[model samples]
Target chain A: MELDPKRYAGKRLLRREIPLSTTALREALQHQYFKQIPTLRKEKNILYCNRCNATQPHLQNINCQNCGSTHLYCRNCIQMGRVSYCEFFYEWAGPNPDWHIHNNPCAWEGELTKHQQIAADAIDQTMKQNGKLLVHAVCGAGKTEMLFQGIATSLQQGKRICLATPRADVVRELLPRFQQAFPTVTVQALYGGSPDKTGDGQLILATTHQLLRFYHAFDVLIIDEIDAFPFHADPMLHVASEKAKKQTCASIFLTATPRQKEKRQIAAKTLPHVFVPVRFHGQPLPVPASKLCFGLHKQLRKGTLPKGLLRWLHNRRNPTRQVLVFLPTVVLADRLQEEAIEVLLPFTQKILPKRETETLIRTVHAADKDREAKVQAFRNRETAIILTTTILERGVTFPSVDVAILDAAHDVFDEAALVQIAGRAGRSPADPTGEVVFFHEGRSDAMDKAVRAIQVMNRRAKRL
Target chain B: MNLCVGCGEAYTSRPSWSTFFWPERISLLCKDCEGSFHRLKDSGCPSCMKQIGSSICSDCLKWEKTSYQGVLEKNVSLYSYEPFMQDYIARWKYRGDYVLGKVFEVEFQKLYYQHFQDTKYEVVPIPLSAERMAERGFNQAGELAAFTRAKRKDVLGRKHGEKQSKRSRLHRLTAENPFQLLSEPPQYAVLIDDIYTTGTTLRHAAQVLQENGTDFVAAFTLIRG
Candidate 1:
């Protein structure tokens, strides 16, 4: 006897916000909430995450490797809240997000490129006609600006929008820009420790992990950096992104480098995509030149750098020109930093005897406690040479910095990562040209493809 | 899909929320691991519920012979201290994983309510020493007591002493009672603890509770070795 489905329309309530406690909720349902249905459905015993609708399958059991039972916990999204079988989640039987017409809500004044405008038009068509669209833009192609038009169109039509990315870092970086652009819209940024819990926003910016909390929640879902780490790797996140959106929602995936599988999908016409091949500055991406400097491991063992590498560092590093040396792993980066310090101390002392040379050299990796501070210091030109791993490969910019990779042939350096690392150089318009050198034992296909990709982009830009 | 909380494996046979009889929620552990533990049978010593081959266990007989003969009543236990349970308790107790308490919460609460449904039995969880409480961040017995229907009364406190697990058998049997009554005692009270190692701690607690007041005192524990 559900006579009025329209009564519950437009009210969006989380499952937990209805009643004070589970017992109270049970009583309310039994006595008051319904009038027609006499019998109750069997209550579920298993726990569902109120924040991230993680069911039994998404949760991992954590037991002691032995016979211990006390250490049992859920492994899926444990970084957020732990949702176990004992935990209870009330159902979301509230109204949907409030939708109202707002005139030109976006406040950003930047103009999209001709290529970006075409892609943005395709995106707007995807939102209106309803289908998934892939924005396969190159790094530094002003992809964020391309999204504003479609987002503004959707906002003007009074649609609930969510822009989710894989990493919290991207969400943090985009939060302020989105807030500044949509000054009239109520935008909520949802992350792990985000203080904004009220789901009364017209626009939502969240990490993809936070999307698990939503159910058929958005009219337009845009996932930026969709091909990035943790999101592309974990199937749980894929399921979450699918579960968080409406059935007829327009899904837009933004990525700089599309993987082979995605490329196949685009080639098959199964995933309609637009490519922005040129960067915003209208310059071709800097193609990395390979210089064979074999026996980096042997040099570390012998407590010295290769002669070619030493000469390159001597010629390349200076106060005005910063250098970023990419190592295969953090451990090797640390070891090379130590060994290079021991070997370069006498040389630096002979070259510049007055200044403290240690301040000129530093190392940063994923696990460094002062990674942000160290990166900021390097950006401020307080440090000249920052030896790092692939952690700084993408989403981080160092203007006019020379890049070098020690083991460019390693399996870890894929074509896309190599492309991104190479894109780091020559980013600033003030210094439009910078050097990117790859020192490897032997040439790799990834290296060849990276160089070929840059040359092809340059060729494409020349034709334009 | 149902996942085993102990091993993190997926099971597709049944829905996760389907319960059998009571509102005890769902089983967190999978089938294979769930079989490793068994509920305690009521076939042994009536006093401490130990599954000895005789009507009265040697430990309970020794208790009868001592001056603390009528100091305590029969103690009820929910589960047997099998090898698997031993390791689970060690990790839960020593490792300080509070979530592990959920595994036994529903079952323990159901059993407690079934036993004392009509009685006005006041439930008192054995209090930890202030030092141990701070170190563990929570009391294990108190956490288990949270699931029970009976109102919990924090009436017993303990003085600082060496850990019971570190002491030898004779030392534990003859250990000085560290428990003291925190308030005026209830007439019929039930003491709760995580385990009944030798029944010395419970007996000592019951002795102090009896000295402070009125009547009979039984004990309920999660496991009995």
Candidate 2:
């Protein structure tokens, strides 16, 4: 129970840090945490992703990535000015190039490609019609630049706009760019660390909770990373997003992994779509080397790891590139990190990679505010390995990285998750090929599906 | 007694027709009683909270006509506006001045409060709308009502009304009711406005409260003229 400060008006309020036993925590968890939130089921829809070259379907009530289409379909066309890439063409086509006409969210500030111009033009038309728009561009497709023109046009027209992202890392990266573009407009970046100043600026970038204080405040709403984190999983956030939009306002959505329902809608031809099949840099998609590691439960029970896996871990402890291990549960993750150190560190020169030569792994989750900084350290090649969950799935992209999942058959390792895991590898042009190991006692259907989806995307890009 | 002379006018019941022509013929308007009477204000348009020359504000073309006919009303603020009203509101609302509210409520019973009995009270505490309640912490009207022993029925919840600050004077509908009923409608009630310079809040409250079940409705503030 919270102490009521009003009851003891004259007494200075002192908040003490209360200590609790695990049993008490567990009891509270059983009662409070387990209480089911009301599930508001919505119709499922389809969305098509040119980056992955696949049309997937998921809940229609989810936030939209292109023009904020909560109800999505996979079919997309890049109209106006667009530069077509063979890889992107294989999944979806772009509009013919026109040099004279201009549009919002110019694909290129100095150099305009055909597909880039096409995507910009489509956004122009959507804004003109006052219709909601969704732009499902590739992760590195320069999605932010594609929105600059749209934002400027909306603001020029006296419309209030807000851009929301689930990841603070993404928000931090985009804040400077927004500030530079609209110097006079009160540009605010809201995350776990701050409050809403959206009113100060016609244009604002905020996380979902910062969205709570607003109701019917915006003329145009842009949701970045539409399928990331709590936005995809939490219902209260979804309601808040809808509440923020004005009755006549349009919404825009952007995401890499459009859930299943989005794919179906595109196939049905009910929702209009636009796709940029290639990355702005136009690099080929990454292809991974998958290995089948079996009998994990048997080895764990025996308190030993396979010789081949042990040797592999030993060689990967390098000075330049670090390794990332993603596990399902915190208990398993901590235990594995401990066991790996005992087996591999003493055999190497840097006994621990950076932190501990003997046990060089650490567990990271979304709950930790230091997650982004820690992951940045790993990317900078400071730590040998960082253990994490699905938190690094989509918004985070690392170059030429190797990924290992211990239990590929676990329920959490679904088709979309495995695709995201595979996407983490080969993000950079230099490192287009990497090793992806699914270490498990048995191969699961989800794993097989992920492998197939990646193969299909790569093959389609190659043929084009 | 010559002490009864107010300012410079002689205190006389009636004067000759020729004396009625000058200052001596004018009615006895004492400086203190006149000040109190002038403090009896009914001059604002509730929707915009603007002080207009006439009763109707520019924003609200229509008035919220209540079911009950005219019972004259004015601001029942604890003191007069400007010179006196400011201190009264501050003490009654802020600096633990329970006596200000109590004295105002008691004085209110002598003038406006006597018209309605307990049965006639469709007592509504001037709603602070949930949004405003969160900011200010407590409702000032509710506190005043407690001092006056006004009925504390939960029937008058704010029903999607625009804020008094944002609206224009003509925007106020003396008839547009915002109060909602939590229970079955009562038969008769008078709305309570803390400061009735503009009748928008009271009209809105009366419109809403009266719709549910109220037959007769009037308004009372702690110190209305």
Candidate 3:
């Protein structure tokens, strides 16, 4: 775009008035490529915006023409909702008629409303500012698209990226999709047994521990389910992230339920925020029914599925929809899995245990990989039902997934846990609905909190 | 004196870095212990634990726990290399899991408090090294150090190290040792390997730790053999 400006420097220049001679154009083009050198080392190109301050990544088009002052950081990006979904934006659409197949469809698909676009624009701004971003979308509101601009812009800014998730299963599921999005950037899917430095890729999708080796490594750090897992639990992981993070790096956190700390940041008006009240698919998350299944956990511990639960399973079983059984502990999952095999052994030729389980892989911490794999298996329609611990309660979605938390009253199924478990169902645009049941010995405070939160999110999603 | 806890085989209590031991330190062993160890050596058996007294002990000379003929160094057991040492080894591993923590803790506190009231030591619990820690969920010396109490304690033992039990005694001695100091490596240090059966493990720690700026690494163990 910058040809010999000297030709027009003394004269007024108009976009259409610049004329190029074939012989001279070649020489000037060479200068642009090789000869136009500045002797002084150009300081890292940093743009400052008055509104967001010099500390923040400067937005490309700051203080839009409509709003001239720089205080333009959006307050809508940091809200947390009940479920988390990634936005998928693509160039070609009508070319593939069946493209809208994802249960949790991204922003690229479906209707791109003005507000959704605004959210995307705001995220792009955050990436430019270069550090610490929060998305504040509501339950059912599509939260994924708000991230596309930030992620893409950061990569454009030449920074390596790792989309860390508390759920290893989520990471596995995300690999193919993110790889699809960022084809040119080498994306490494790392978790346990991550082979040593084959070579550093432009982007690395890893668990929190895998990030221990990296600090300031990524230009953009997108932490999905930041409020979940060892990411929130371990200080060492935090230290690793701090070490790996480049100074003034871009960090985006996507969580459905905004924790108290983030809420404070939003209320204090220190962080840029964006909120999508309505889901892009135009439907609310499903509400789970709560009940006391009467010693449901005891039956599981005894290595037996409860008689009532068997009847309930039969009632929920229909070839039309998929079911997910959520438990509080892996020990219980083993017991329930055994019982399911014994009961269903007669009808099916095979009973594949939850394959792709990150949670079951380790005896110590929840196997986030196996946890995500179970959900994926459910999504692929290979497993009729997947059993899991409370790790699956939040931050994962599968369309047409009907969820039942056996032993829902276990302290593990707290209010937050219950809401998240129930939110798993009704994530698909095609079905846009599903059933959720909390089968517990007795509804605990967590159960009450879970139900109330779901009803609240439901009420909120409706108002939007 | 470098006494073998196995049979109380005491050699010099100093760094033996002559041309003979510099490349290899078989001379560090007392005459009695050296003869006894060599007498028990068998073919291809490197580790003393694996020796049948053939030519080179099958286990000690072969390597740490793995690696063929890669035992980093030789160890001299002062007592019955097998039957006697085996008993206490089992107790230290199984029965003394928590109990020995107290023993080590009391010993650490008493030793550190009484002897060196003025100086400081970042007590690095002899790493079972990495191989042993992996095989045994926790390192014995590391665990003992965790339970061991002492005055003026600075975070010690190792945050990281090489897989010692994974390789042979010879490999460890020859290959660059892998013991890291988590704290600011002290000028004067104390290495607490589980046992002093063969000074191989301690020597490796001392070498590597010293390389990282630790001085006077008084290699300590419950038993010297």
Candidate 4:
């Protein structure tokens, strides 16, 4: 007897949520209507999360220090339910869904560029064939728009699609865009504390952590920011992501910075990928120039920026322009904020207008309150310059903003981070060539690699 | 590999004279974790066995002044709720790690036999609410009672509400009767819980059994918080 998979389709019910007991299931088994339907597949020793499909051993053991139970709970996917040694989680393995049909779902009227159209067609073809592909596009290359065709194709075929990213912020940002593109398809953002936890949605925009609660739920899984933090580093989340998709589901990896391993796989012809080197506006990436500046940390500690850096800041001051000063660490950013106010304010007051002096500098890091408001202020040109840590390195766009890396030679400033930070400038069509300066004690290989990567992309874009 | 229940680390045992004397006894915890748990000595309150300088602890004195005074005669706890024991107990109770109950099997069995071997009392593990039992999978007290020789019964049950550990001390004292008598209890009953936190839960449980015609009740907890 095969269970109807349509009965469990888009239904993510925890055992606690099921208002029935083993006796009720037994009764169902004895009943005339449900007697022929296959019941749950029982698994022991390893409790599987029916909501996220995360199995035992992959689940982290969380000891409750308050109650003194050694193996009292599961923390791996605890938000769904505490899957313990005593409990069992079940899955429905009966039949596949029959309704793979829908109307024209995409409502977006925007046209893709020639380069974007070619890549978009390839994506749709690959998705239809259930193939794995890496969409290796540069930052600001209309990567999100290229995904629209593939998403629309999947929706028209009535297949479940999930667009997962590494961070919650990206999920939130992509939710409305996806909803606007596929207005007919049900789109819901799935993250921690999401309101639509139990609702069935055809399209799911979720953080990678949220995928732990989904077991073989999607027919198509698109992982945006494939090389981002937590998703790139954590293997448990990778397992969860894989577990969330159907066995024959197509996977699409979207990233600006491809890892060495991914690149090698692509080179070896084992992984299929499409590269879009040019920006949507048909412009090359802004290249960063490095300048040698020794003892900047000592100067920051001594309450003064170097004369050359101060002069550069003074020269770049305009009401229409915003500057981003990237620091290596939060502590360094905080210390520099105090020193900048003391040393740079008097210098700014002597040169700039009074209203502009009020919005000279603001500092933001991971711990800062009103983070969104501060970032909005910078975007609106209310702040002339904002000093920050690596939190604002990626997924942030500000028009006509110049970037300065405080210590580009620092070990924390890897090539990927440098490339992302450099990408912050020259994003908008109106300001397609903004200044990116790397003030370093000594030029590191990471800095050189970043410059070389940008030059290679520009060369490729020009040839295309 | 046999792992330590306290720290979840694999530890090997060396042959020693203690092992020879007690051949049946096995090393349940790693050496470092074994050293961290501090067992209570006989130099404290006779009522709850807390390490006060008097026979009656201040907590027991405070309990006596309450409305449900003298219901719980005495409570003999095994270990002090030190940081290590706190973590050990938490893992067993809240985390649903039922296998960690093996660490306390031998010593708790010894205590159960030594204290109530001659007494005609039934061991009643504090019953979990339907919601909590489904969530935690097993009751910590019920699992711990497997070590004792007394006949266990589902004599008392609790109405689901806010957990006692989540409530303040004042609120816990003023909390309403959450326990219900499921079946006829024996003349003497022995209450079992994982920890003796503020003693309000134990006092309430003891009061319910006493109100239902049980002559006397004592408590045995794994740790005294």
Q: Which candidate's TM-score is highest?
A: 4
Give a tens-digit lDDT track for model 2, residues A79-146. 11111111111100112111112224222245545666777777766765668666766545557767
Docking class of 2: incorrect
Once fitted onto the true fold, the runs of candidate 3 whose alpha carbons sit more than 4 angstroms away are A1-115, A138-142, A196-199, A317-319, A344-379, A394-397, B1-225
Better by TM-score, candidate 4 or 2:
4
Write down the TM-score for model 1. 0.62
Measured by DockQ, the strongest candidate is 4
Regions of candidate 1 where Cα sits further than 4 Å from its true position? A1-74, A195-200, A300-307, A317-319, A338-360, B1-225
TM-score, model 2 to reference: 0.48
TM-score of 3: 0.52
Q: Give the per-residue lDDT digits (tens) of candidate 4, residues A156-234.
A: 7889988888876667667888888877777889876677665357788888887776667888999988888878977
DockQ of each: 0.04, 0.01, 0.03, 0.07
Cα deviation of A328, candidate 2, in Å: 1.2
Candidate 4 residue-wise lDDT at A74: 45
Task: For model 3 chain B, give the 10-residue run with minimal summed lDDT.
Answer: B94-103
Q: Write the per-residue lDDT of candidate 4 for residues B49-100, one digit (tens) a residue.
A: 8898867988888888878789998998899988667767776677656556
Query: Best-fitting candidate, measured by lDDT?
Result: 4
